[model samples]
Structures are given as structure tokens and as C-alpha cells.
Target chain A: MPTSFPPPTGDAEAEDTLSTLGEFGLIARLNAGRAQPAGTLLGPGDDAAVVAAPDERVVACTDVLVEGVHFRLDWSAPDQVGRKAAAANLADIAAMGAVPTALLVGLACSRDTPVETLTALVDGLWAEAGVVGVGVVGGDVAASPTLVLSVTALGTLEGRAPVTRAGARPGDVLAICGRVGWSAAGLAVLARGFRSPVAVVGAHRVPDPPYAAGPQAAKAGATSMIDISDGLIADLGHVARASGVLLDVRSRAFDVPARLVDVGAALGVDPLQWVLTGGEDHALAATFSGPLPEGWTEIGTVRAGDPAVLVDGRPYEGPPAGWDHFTR
Target chain B: MPTSFPPPTGDAEAEDTLSTLGEFGLIARLNAGRAQPAGTLLGPGDDAAVVAAPDERVVACTDVLVEGVHFRLDWSAPDQVGRKAAAANLADIAAMGAVPTALLVGLACSRDTPVETLTALVDGLWAEAGVVGVGVVGGDVAASPTLVLSVTALGTLEGRAPVTRAGARPGDVLAICGRVGWSAAGLAVLARGFRSPVAVVGAHRVPDPPYAAGPQAAKAGATSMIDISDGLIADLGHVARASGVLLDVRSRAFDVPARLVDVGAALGVDPLQWVLTGGEDHALAATFSGPLPEGWTEIGTVRAGDPAVLVDGRPYEGPPAGWDHFTR
Candidate 1:
């Protein structure tokens, strides 16, 4: 029984395009060598995938990445784009104090797209999911004028209560794990048409989200947590409003990386400003009343005031107010 | 505390574009007035949503619908398009013999898209989800050149084993639980630019999947199940190959509806061909070794032979070979 569509024949170059390979062929190619994790009871090929949700609950989130809006093919490889798309949603799951279990991708691209590009992009999705021992369980593909990746990640909380953005209290201390402003610096470098600073440019390409730190924070009794996708200040604003408390960050709390400092000097931009206002780093920010978890740096505190984010006791002045899809 | 983005003000007409309302505002509008089901532990407004997976396993799948590819705004209302998109993924869940729990949508569209259209589309998503007592728990929206809706549905098996496509035996009876080829008939009329025959046209716009019949068939000891999204013969091919048995459909078994026959006669086309090869009505086709479930009509028989779908024991001869996104 031949379950797959007929294999492509004739000239190899003509068969390289998605249109030549057809939808089923592309799907078969993308799923050819992928490995499923233990949590994946059933992987791709089925109508729906079944994944283990040991905690009796599933934490799920979706993040959509448009080609021009989120990344450029010239700046990042297809694999990198795939990784970033997966990271965005995986980080969201982690922000809820959950361990990611599976990812489902929905890709819409032009018929002229190269089959190689699609395969590499899926390879990146697999690589990132492999980081947490998860699998790309299922997805759908369609033909569109532009490339769009919509990734949905599912996770389990391991029996712990989810640490939401609305749990911060007046006396809680603010802490963060993972880098900030690196992606912003990377974007600035890319905007200047210089790709020499591989560090920041790579950061902009694929975020290294602290996935394990989420469960660690929850186990350590953190009250509130959020993924820093929209800069330190803008994302904290969400927490501030959600928790009904003012969050105040210290100016000197961050130890900006030397690479960013050197790049800031060369570019005539303040690295600290990027740390305070840049986004897309996918860092974890949480509030704790007890001792901070290892690897988390204390940077601010929650206070009794109007729901707002403050820098060094007052609102910080900045033009980079974080990424807003339509506004930008 | 203002958890929502600021309410729209100024001229109502000016505030109607997605650009004017912004991403957060549009999300708020889509989420406003919608009720969450009991299975939703955490709905939108956070990094992720938590849904109850009471059976310790979750069934998940993704389906993408493009504006021009899967639908046309002029042909179908935004809400109808939304309902169809949600129905596509929800039917996949039901086909797995699972009860739908939640949905996460990923929408990418031009910035100038109408706010009303987006809201209406979401309203349709909510309307369809409400039918099954589920919620649109979380999703993401982004700016793109075209509109694309990627919906991910999660479900629970409720202690029942999933009726997969590979479980059929040689002597199983093939049955169907819903209309087939009606959407194809509607599409034929729409392609010819005639909107009259409202019944078939409406079916093309929004599918009425027998959601309960999936679980009902599973409970009746059905060996295999599949959603007929690609067409009766084409989808049956999947079951035939997966089950390693030949599926032979009896042409006399189906009583083609008079509406399709009238339309087919008017168009000088065979209505039975549409019933055999037309897709997108989202009917359930399953193989049973035991007595058929209520509402199921036996249409074929599974036999020991090379894996293939046969119309009266021979290969189906037609041009409407089911829907394939890339090839078509």
C-alpha cells in the first residue's frame, strides 16, 4: 500500500519548487526524518496528534510570524526563522510556568518557494523543539502570496499552580533570567546594513529563551512571571496593570554585556537604553517575595502606586517603546 | 487598573480600521463579550492559556485557511469564513473520537483590514466553538499582505481509545454520517458566477459537520474513522491505505439530494460525480466491524485486496480528484 503521493520524477531542478512537488509531497518531505519524543503518543500523518498532558491540563499559546514583519530571508536563514517562530510560542508556554510538550506549525507560503527552504525551516522547528525534548506533532500548509508561520505550543505545569502576570504584590522583588536588548542591538546592527557583529545579529535571528527557568521560578515560589518579548519596560507595564501595582526598575541593576557596550560605542547608541526598552529577547521576568532563584538577577521591586512601570522612581523617557505590530 | 488597551475614540468610521485600533485593541474587541467554557482554566490576556485535559492526553491539530485560497471575502461573509476555518480543525478533532476542549487562532492580515471584518470573523469562530461548548482560549494576530487564519484545536478522548485510520479489518462495513459533495456543488455554481441555489451555496460557505457522530461511532466499536475534507473517494483512499484493505463504494448506496441533481441537470453535469469526488462538506467516513452507529448510513464494504478506493470495484474516473492546495 503506497500511503504517500507518487514520488517526483524528471529534472531535479523543476522538482525543487513546491508547485512541482505538490502539497502532499512537501508534507512527506518535511516529515521524512523527524523524530517524536516520548510525550508524543501519535505524531504527524494522523488526523490529529495525541500528546501526554501529565498534569491533567495543557498550557497553549499561538504566535504568528510574517516574513517581512518578523524577519528577512537575507538576514536570517529559513531554519533561523523557523527557530524564532517556535521560540516565540515556546517562551509563552514557559512564561506560564509550564514545560513544553509539543508544537504544531501552520505555514502559508507562495507556490514558488523552494522545497529546500521549507525543509530547512522545518528542520529549525525540529531543532528548537528538540531542545526541550518536545516534538513538532502536527501542522498544516497552504499556498499564499507571502510566507507566514503560525506556531502553537502546548505544555504541562507539572502539578504546580500557574504563575500568571497578575500575581505580583507590593513587596515582591523583580528578577530576570536570560539576556535583554541583545536582539535590539542585533536589529540595530542589521538596520545599519552591517552584519559583522555576529553576536547581536544572531540574537536577533534566534532567541535563546530560558525555558527551564520558568519551572524553576514556579518551584521557587515566584508570584508572577512574563516573557520579555516587548522590552523590559513595556512588558512590565502589562504586569503592572494586570497586578494593579507599580513596578520600579533600577537604572544600574543590569550588567550590560561588553559586546553590546562596544557595539553601542561604535554605533553611538546607549546599550542600557536598549536593555530598558528593546524587545524580542524572550527573557523571563518574575516577581518573588522569597529568595530569588539561582541564575536570576534582582533588578527592581513592586510598589504601592498606580498601575505603571517606573524607572529609578520615575517614568523613563524613550522612543523605543517596544514592538507594536500595527503601530510600527 | 486598565488591563485593556485604551478604548477607541474620535470618529467611529476612522476608528474602524485595524491600523487605527491597533493589535491589542483588535484582540480586545475579538475577545470582548465571548464566554469561556468550563474547560478553560485561563483564557486570553496572558502569555498562554491553560485548558483542562482530563484524560491526561490532548489531541491537537492545525489547519490553515488563506483568504483567496480557502475563501473569498466577496463570496462568503467574514463570519462564515471564520466558522469554516474553525469547523475544519474541530472536525479533525471529532474524527479522532475526542471532545473538543479549546481553540487557538493565529491571524495574519493587512493592517488596513476593517476592524468590523476581523471582529465578525472572530464572532463566527466563537459561534462555532460555542456549539461544542469550547472556547477560543488564546491566539495571535500579525500584519501581512494577505489574510490567513491558522486554527489549532485541542481535545480529550474522555477515556475512549482514538479510532485511527489504520484499525479497519478486511470485512468491515464503510459508512458515512453527513452530507458529501454539497460544498463541491456550491463551488461549481459559484465558479460559474451564479449565486442562486442557496442550499448548496450555503453549505459551501459553512460546513455542518456531525460532531457528535465521531464519538458515537467510536463508542460503537468502529475500527477506523476519517474526516472527508478532500472528497469521498480521495479521503477513503487514505483509510484504504492505512488499513491495508480495499474500500469498494457501492454507487447505489448514496441517494443524491434533489438539490444537487437539479443543479447538476441545469449545469449539464453529473451530480453523482460531485457526491463521489467533491470535498469540504466535512462528513465523517468510518469502517465498522460491528453494528453501525445511529445516523450512519452504510455506503461501502472493506475487502482483502491491494489498498485502493474503488467506485463499484473499479478506479473512479473523473477530473474532480479532490482538493489539493499546491497542485490545484
Candidate 2:
């Protein structure tokens, strides 16, 4: 079983590098003693993992997190990095309005990387997957010059049509479930050496995606949905482009919570901009023609217009540029 | 769509780095003109892809290829590297006795990586997937200091039970359906810079695993099976340990083909060692309790004993400690 969070800053077991354990030993150690998921027909140690697809169709996606660009070893714990990697991919599966069932984590790191770090990463993966009531089905490990996590998630739709981004129509209300820009705020906090706001730092380390909101929104007749991983405006632009509709955000609609407001003020940055352009919250943003879902809050409106995102009746020209891995 | 291979060593388009085009633009360009596979219910451009799972069961596996460790950019063309990466994972699906259906690729590379290199890699991926009658389904891209490709392949069992390594029993005939050590020999030739035998070099670049032989062996009621990814003895040892049987190879049984012998002679390397201990052949090795499958050639026999592998009635100790990333 994955060990519980033992102080992220602790480095008691960093002396054991992977070269000592070798490839098979390291893989066995990572998955040893862990309980397999119920839906796994065949688990690790096989040629491939056989996962039970309850439905006839499967939903799948992949995401890669690089070492320095995606997360710095100095800034985030190995456990947090593992959790964030799994969370990012899990959120994508959720945005498809499907229930996640399996994960295949691929790790590439320097051979000198401490085995304890890898173990902690797997522990974090197990913890996050445990929240979804599943487990890591398969994985790959390799030696590289840097650390990289490429995670692929598998889910089932339970006999429902997927809520794709191109489904949004005119006159649909755009609402969001879960907090936005908290992660970006957390990044700022970590940068400025302000450790008081524990929530912000935690958000930056491990995003708390509203896991239940995806299926809930789908059941509530949402026409289109997306998770805010690349900021509200940037993700909304994807919907706008894909659906060929304009999304107009009403600034008054979002009541900036005190957590964000307080953090932004301390750093001399606008928290609303984080809400608008900050990504990585993994919050669900959806367009609905009917009444909004219980967890969703109205944030914008959709109309038949040139494919674009409008903030308060004008194009958004904010300071927070969207997060694109290459550009960043 | 993935562009056609212009030339193996062409550098005309290598000047356009990934940073210039950015993430979204690069992704859009990579996938813009591509055609989706028939089984892809929802292709790329979505948060997640929906693929038809015809059997209500999915066989999944992943493999990560890191630059320098897995391949050298200077040694291989971008296309060959991509194909090799995809082939490694696809071979796993074949080893499961399943049909390859979908792929999710995650790529991380330096910002200075040429756009053409990325395109050629995708081209290689597509070319190999086409060999299996499918195409890329979903993927993620990131920026890092080195190039990495993490590929996850999904396959369907078509209602057949998985042929695991733990099924071989006493008195089973051990046979293999694909050529072994060709890749290892090819690697030797490449290392020595002997370019005359193009076939040997190509095998090292992209392995041609016997994809059909897997399901064939399963259908033929092979009690145990494995792909020779980490060398014959190493992989056989896995089967021996799992199945609790001793596998003894008859020296005279294997007819080392002329091509392998010719190549070995040219490089002054023992081809038999490559055949015995070389890795990355991806050949299907199986133990059949019934009549041997038509294409499979008898090489060894399985006996109920302490789990071990022997050559010509004796324990075999040879060079080429199988490819383990951290150790290598």
C-alpha cells in the first residue's frame, strides 16, 4: 500500500538511487503490497493490464509533465508532483463526463534519482487513485537525464454520450464548478516565499479538482464542458473555437472569494486575473441550455458570434497569458 | 496529418524550433490534416478521446523512450525513433494476444527541437500504427530539456482469455514464431558503422514483431507465452518462474538464418550470442501442450522442475545481461 503523506520536506530515504535496485526491482517495489483495483482483470507484472470496460466504449487521454517546466523538484514534493500528474490526467477524464477506472503512469528520470522519491511518487499516485476508487493498472519506468511523468487515464461512459466541447449552442449559460486560479495563486505564494497561506501552496502542489462535478454536470444536461487547466479564458477559447460560438463573461457574475482576494493583494497582483487567465485549477466549466447543476455557478453566457471569448462585452486583454508548455 | 518522410538526414526544416510555433499551434498543425481511425469515436481536439471497445475489455500497456538512453538523435532519424517507440508498446499488446486499436502519445522535448523533427516522429508513429490498422487517438506534449516519448497502446481481446506467462506446464514444446537477435545484431552493425546490410539497421530502428502469431498461439491453445523484449533467456526465465517449469533449449534446434550469420561475420561478432542474449527482438515465445502451431519452430522443451532455463541440457551463462534501463 502507498505510504501516507510523511512530511513532504523530509528526505530521510534519498540516499538509495534507482541504479542500486535496477529496473525490475524498482517497479516491483513501487507496486508491491498494493491492492489491485476490482475492475482489473489482469494487473501489473503481465505483458499488459486487462481492464474491465463495463461499457462497450472506452474514454482515454494522455498528459505529460516535465521536470523543470511543469514542476520543479525544489518547489514541490515528490508526492505532490505525483498527485498533480495523476490529477491533471484524471481531470481530463472527468471533463469527458466519464468515470475514471484505470491509469498507466510512465516515468522517465535520471538513474541517480532516489528510489525513495519514486516510491513517494507512486504513493501519491495510489492515494489520488484511491480517491477515485481505483488504482494504477500499469506503468513504465526508464532512465533519462530529467524527470518526466506521462500519465494515461482510462474511463467508461456508462452508456451515455460524451459531453464534447463542440456541443455548446447559442443562448447557453456558461457556468463553472470548483474554484479557479487557486493554483496560480499558489504558485505566486511559493515564488514570493509567503508560506502562511497553506491552502494556496497546497493548491499549487496538488490541485483539488471537483471530482464529482463532471458526472453531475453531464447528468444535469450540460451541452458542453471543460476543465480549467489552461485558465478560464484560455479554455473558454477552446470551446469558442470548437463550437463556433462566442462566450461572454460577466465579471459581476463571479464573486472573487476572500482566499484569492487576500492572496493577490499581498503580492500586488490582481486575483481576478488569476481567475481569468490562471490555469491548473482543474475546475469544470460547462455550457447548459437548461437550469444549472447544483454545484455550478453562472460565470458567462454563450451566443452565436465570431469564434472568440469576450470579457464584459470586449475581448480579454489581460496580463496573464495562457499556459502553453512550449511558450512558457 | 503526419508528413511523409522527406529524407532520412535532411536538415532543411530543422531550423524551426518548437518555441517559435508554440504548443497549441504545433498540436493543431500535427493533427490538422490527419485522418481519424474508424474505431476512434472521438479523436483528438477533445479533452479525452472516445474509442470503441468492441469486447468490453481493454488490454493496455505503456512504454517510455528517453533520448540518449533509448535512442540517440544523432544515430536515428526522427521518424525511426518515433516508430521504434510506438512499436515497443504495440508489441506488448501483441504479446497479450490482442489487436491493437488505439494509441495515446505523450511527448516532452527541449524548446530548441526542430518542428520538422516532431512532425517526422509523428509520421513514424502513424506509419507503424497504420501497419496495425489504426492511428493515434489522443496525446499530450510538453517542453523539457530532453526528448521523451511515452506511448500507451490499447488493444481488444475479442473475447479470448489472455495468454499469460504462468500457463506453461510439464512436457510442453517451447517454440518461437519470430526471428530473434536480429535487432541486437543490427545494433552491433550500427555501432560499428557498417551500413551495407540495410535490413539489419532497419531492424534496430523499428522491430517487426510477429503481431499475428500472438493471437494465433492463443487460439492454438499455447499454455504459456512471452515476447522476447529483454532477451530470450531473460524472458523465458519469467515464464519459467511464473509457470514453475524448467525450459531447456536444444542447441541443434534453432537454424540461425544466413542473414544473421552473414551480418555477424561482417562485424566479427557472435550472432548466436545476439540470438541468445540480445534484447528488443519482440519475438513471440510460447510453450504449447498441443501440436506445435504451424509457424512456430521448436527450440526447447518445458519440464516440471525448479523454475530455470538451460541451453543443451546445462545452465547457460552468456554475455548481454538483458537491457535494464538503470543498469545500462
Q: Of the candidates shown, which would achieve the greatest lDDT relative to the real structure?
A: 1
Which residue pairs collide, candidate 1?
Answer: none
In terms of docking quality, model 1 is: high
lDDT of 2 by residue, A101-180 (tens): 89999999888898889999989888888889878999899999889999999998888899999999999999999988
TM-score on B-chain, cand. 1: 0.96
* Predicted structure with the largest TM-score when compared to the true one: 1
Q: Which ten residues in a row have the lowest lDDT in candidate 2 chain A?
A: A1-10
lDDT of 1 at B312: 92
Model 2 scores a TM of: 0.95
Q: Model 2 segments beyond 4 Å from truth? A: A1-14, B1-14
For candidate 2, the per-residue lDDT at A91 reads 90
- Candidate 2, position B309, lDDT: 92
lDDT of 1 by residue, B195-286 (tens): 97999999999999999998999999889999999899988988988889999999999999999999999988899989998989999999
Model 2, B98: alpha-carbon shift in Å? Answer: 0.6
